[model samples]
Target: MKLFHYIVTNRLCHILSTIVIAILISTTCHAAKTKYIWQSSDQFVALEQQDSPSTNTVAPNDHPATVTSETISAMLSSLEIRATDSDKPEPLFTAVAVQSIAPQILQGLRQASPTEDVTFAVIGLHNTSYGFVKSHKVTTGRVYYQAGRLNILIGQAQKEVNDRDDRRLAPFTPGSRHKTSEGDWQLLPQPGQKGFSLQRKDWAAFSTEWQPPAAVQSVSPQQSIPAGLIAPARQPSPADRLIVLKELKEKGLISEEEYRSKRQEILNLL
Candidate 1:
């Protein structure tokens, strides 16, 4: 009877050990399978985002729509614009007819075939009016609206240069007079406008119309240079000058030739 009890206890212990080992192996395999699934899904999602176009974040005020005074106003406001001139009143946005914008500029902005004649709009903000070209129901380009008429500033220097309420409308940057089969749709500075030219070149005039960078006050060269050339009153030392020159080059303020020339001049002075 003692021998029979001992044999039964050993068989029971062996059975329990086998059950525990099977459970451990099964759990580890499941955990590894789950980890692999998660890794593969994360990689697929990351690849999709990389291939997609940059998403345009919706502004607090943005409401996507076609051309209209009310809609254009909302669109301009959506840009979160600040006034260029403090004295200027809030602008009243207006929709422009499809025919008003230059054909080349119009065509360039709109690539959708079966291109319904797109109606652009002029929005007044930042002290001047900007042409709003629509693409996929969003304002794409801030053009010079209606040549020079809508661009009048609160205190314009050239008040004499004016456009009639009724006039042929063109873009701020119109291509040169030279004939091209598709029309000179090339961007600004391509043909380059002369300051003296009678034609309204608002492209050059208001190139910085949209959110002109904050004004930076600069010291005049004469003010910085001492009255006497023998010794500079405010001139930086050679080491300081080299540092400044390096900074200017890094910031793209000076050309390579100018940098080399100025550096040599400073060295010679030392």
Candidate 2:
């Protein structure tokens, strides 16, 4: 009888130890997956990180649609200008989108697309000094596409003037324009407005191949398929199906049980 009691007690202790170890592992994983929220900067300073999750929600009017490469090119083709006291309009030197960066969930901001928001690092150049001198005015900023419109928020602007001998004229004048007091979200002005007037320009000369970043490319459903095998009616491979299923589960579009069942179904195809 004593031997039976000892065996039962030993088994119970082992089970309890296993349960505690599993709980610790689960907690560690949850903590590692925590992401930081960042705030937009005016001086283009390093983004401030926040520990809490963002509570921001998108409004109907501000929700962005899925963006394509053409959409980005279209936005970059237009230059924003503001009417000055003189007859000639003053160019705001709006930066053009040169590279696409992965969109992040910003606090008090909405996603720019179905899966994520679209962001771009932009650059603009103009002549700070009159004539065909070597003096150049450069502006850098970030562009966010939302509500079918491009919202540009200039981060920093500086004028670098060089002499006829290619010598430095000034010590890189900073903040050449008037200081902007608007918040990050408030900087987005409607098209044709003073700060956001869209003046069309010939952008074909400046065109470059635009490809989504690697992070965005990985989530594409067609990434694993060969080019020759691509067709409108072609069926997705088991690997492709599994990739999509996992994405849906991560996005919370499917429940845990549904994910497990669908995942098993895709694995069976292999």
Candidate 3:
């Protein structure tokens, strides 16, 4: 009776050990399947498992598409950004003049890395209580591609309008992104706002209206001027310099003393 009991007890121990080993293998495989392709403080792009039912997952058949210059232009024109003081949102590019320089804004998205970002000036019209106002703002945007889908995040716009500097308005900032739905691209909301969508057909219209103007030649200092037609040297206005200095301070690029000194200098110029 003792011998039989000993054999049965040994068999039971072996079975229990087998069960534990199997469980551990399953847990490890599940953990391996879940990973983040990109992440930030408040946002992330993760690779989901096939069993996940999340709507954010990209379909298997939908391969990742390279973002083209046209894509960038279309995305920028479709953005519905509103200033904090404005009542209603408006397309970031309203006037043809602002749209003409869209090509110059396509930096950072075409990088070889899977994750990248770009910052550019945003010129748009906003409707205030008084009337329509033109706003020159600055914003940063991040982009990444994973598992056949593109993810984008656009930061809040900083009101950095310098009316005296036409060149500041010429630099463009690319906008945010979301999944493509029925041949249309959508703009995912920044933190506390509702999302917006734009159709592919609409992009065609925007591209046509936003054709860039012919390149202008710059006058070199070495070039000779007419005997009586010497022109005053062009320089950034005091207001423009002050705006740039303020931006540097806000970005933590300059010390308080430096910012104050530069600000005073610009003020003195006025």
**Each prediction's whole-model lDDT (CA):** 0.30, 0.37, 0.43
- Model 3 regions lying over 4 Å from their true place: 1-53, 56-107, 110-112, 115-211, 215-235, 249-255
Which candidate comes out best when scored by lDDT?
Answer: 3
Q: Which candidate number has the best TM-score?
A: 3
Error of 3 at 70 (Å): 15
Q: What are the clash counts of all predictions, listed in order?
A: 0, 1, 0
By summed lDDT, the worst window of 10 consecutive residues in model 2 runs over: 167-176
Q: For residues 10-49, could you state the per-residue lDDT of candidate 1 as single tens digits?
A: 9999999888676667655533432111111011000000
| Number of the candidate with higher lDDT, 1 or 3 | 3
CA deviation > 4 Å runs, candidate 1:
1-73, 77-89, 95-161, 164-171, 174-270
Rank the models by lDDT, top first. Answer: 3, 2, 1
C-alpha displacement of 98 in model 1, angstroms? 11
Model 2 Cα lDDT, one tens digit per residue, 223-254:
57667653366465565466456656766789
RMSD of 1: 25.9
